[model samples]
Target: MSQSQKKIHYAWVVLIGLIVMVGAAKGGIMTTGGLFLTSITEDLGIGMGSLTLYFSIASIVTMISLPIAGKLIAKYNIRMLLVVAVILEAGSFAMFGFMNSVWGWYLFAIPMAMGSVIVTQLAGPVLINNWFKKHRGLAMGIMVAAGGLLGAFLQPAAGNLIASEGWRNTYFILGLGVMAVVIPVVLLTIRMTPQQKGLQPYGMDEVKHNETIQVEKTANSGVTVAIAKKSSAFYFLIIFFLFDTSIAAFNQHVAPYAVGLGYDIKFAGNAMGSWSVGVVIGALFFGFLSDKIGVKNTAISAMFTGLVPVGILIIEPENPVMFVIATGLYGFVVASLGTLGPLLTTALFGNKEFSRIYGLAIMGLAVAGIVAIPTYGYMFEITGSYTNVLYAIFIMLIMNVGAILLAFKGKKKLEKAGLWN
Candidate 1:
């Protein structure tokens, strides 16, 4: 076949491989962490507040490492960087089986956070930006949906494993499993971009001739972090992400909260599993909706839906079914943030310095991790209930809605200034 008529582009294949690698690595750890929290606390005879402090430390490490990771991704080949990332992430997880003291978690959390930053947070968006010029939002949505799908399956499986094998073995098995799956996949299929394979993005051919000509002229005109930072839209976008993520921190404590309310571990796990199911559905739906209704509207709708679960938790639902329904609704909003967050950024600011800008923006998420989870734990430690945390989440939800509205208003200012096309 002639060069232009070659059969396979290979970049799409790489994209699929990344989806699986990221999904398994992230789902196996993040979604499963809460399931193990109760078991580990019981076995180790540690307070939940203290055990949760390890997560806070991890978030602090992640914040410190992000700028360095950003520099590495820009400077190095993606394959080597991802390989190191998976090893750090999975290896740290497996080593958790050996920890008998809180200090062990504090130390291991550093590497785990480092690996997670690369594989879970940075890899997907950077790869999607490199691979697909058109339908980029759809691609990002699918990637995040892949992670939720894995979580939907793996979370329940993790709960079952914890029930059967104990938490230590559970962590060992999952960590090793993620490593076994991700290592070969990254080495075999992950690539930096379509250009590295000498092929164009999959949909480039469908552009109208006039649009095709414009691609070359504007290829270098993508937005940079410097320009993005100068806009008010960027600041409001950060605020939007911060509040959205603070609400999501509730997932880290959902099982514990249920168990604290007199439910069995199995029931708590099943409740969390239901929440994951909502995540799967919401990710796919809101991802598509963001494309149609616009990012600002989609974000506002998500934050608005966040109020449902807080209401249920605060009202202290007597019926188990009501509790499950309310938490499931919250899960849907949380998943929408996963799909919409990056897309909103891309919409507000083009993909010029996408990695750097996104890196900076997700620092808010890291900060939320630092504050929200441990604060929930500490609130429970002090009051013996999650009521205060729920109230705080409700307030953050309201503020998030206002923040997103301000983002759109800010975007108009940027547009008028010729900052965004």
Candidate 2:
């Protein structure tokens, strides 16, 4: 290795920025969302179903935006994109402070989803893929773990803020606060690729310098977007995405569920915070596990672990101690959405068409949001309980195991057909 190449890689710097940026955007905004659900509905005289429908609306926008976001990220300067993205996202979030009508969330959902598509969903995985060729799973886990760590602190804080300051003021403060923090971080640290820094991706130096091997690597691994789109592996991955998102969507109702059980907002906040802590530990564990055991096995294990929490919720929803423990365990399993999702994609399709295939694949996530978020809310509204939703989530969590197996089975077929070659 050259002496210069041995110097500290800038990819770590990019990752630091990503940890903060995505953390604040997701942990600061998205994870804190449940804290506001009941407060918004009660204050505005809206039903839970009607109010949570805005989340579905936002998901619809996210669904439409993912492909466009993929292209924009490819075409535009990332720093500039992130600056505008955070502004739109946090700005729209703050704008909610002024709305007495549901239309405010509905209208802002467009810009909010657009901005989040760039910030939370796309940037971390895409950039990590560009920068870290080794320990990529670890990198993805750290990014998601940042959100968990930050959200752990933010959730209870937000809950207390809602109690003292009201949801409106809380919204304004969080939005502006995240914007002030995330925008500058983006400009200082993020880059689209390692090439922009005149460096090879981390660990690229380890590859053997043989022409035939390089050619074979490309030939065997370079699954184009067009070919990926036609492959059964791709479709099965999408199905897994859908079921996974559906399972995770139950989190949006955690606070509301607690409230319905007569727990105060502060308790709900603390419970969600516990969930965040679970996320931190879970993300790191799964990432490391994927590296050690493999993505397929780790995913199946996660699905099984996830069932424990769902069962606890079903059997002991009103038990405060059990509720917190269950939700925290559930949060750990949900880390799969961020960690395993991208890892599984790279495992099945390689990185040749990663952005496009992943872009299309995560649309399942948005679609689940559209379908599952308000559906859970309506389940509560209609039944006067969350019992039915819990059952549905349990079923979906088990179904995810099947989906994971099917996805890998399809990938094996693709490899056998020489599509991967």
**All candidates: CA RMSD (Å):** 2.2, 1.7
RMSD of 2: 1.7
lDDT of 1 by residue, 64-157 (tens): 8888888898899888888899889999998999999978888999999999998988878877777777666667677777777787788778
Q: Give me the candidate number with maximum TM-score.
A: 2
Best by lDDT: 2
For candidate 2, what is the lDDT? 0.90
Instruction: For residues 1-421, write the lDDT of model 2, one tens digit per residue.
Output: 6886778788889999999999999888988888999999989998898888889999999999999999999999999999999999999998988999988888998899899999999989999988987788898999999999999999999999999999999999999999999999999999998889898788777666775477446632657788888887888888889989988888889999999999999999999999999999999999999999999999999999999999999999888999999999999999989999999998989888888889999999999999999999998999989998988888888888888888888888888888785
Tell me the TM-score of model 1: 0.94
Q: Cα deviation of 34 in candidate 1 (Å)? A: 1.0
The segments of candidate 2 whose C-alpha lies over 4 angstroms from its true place after superposition are 2-6, 208-220
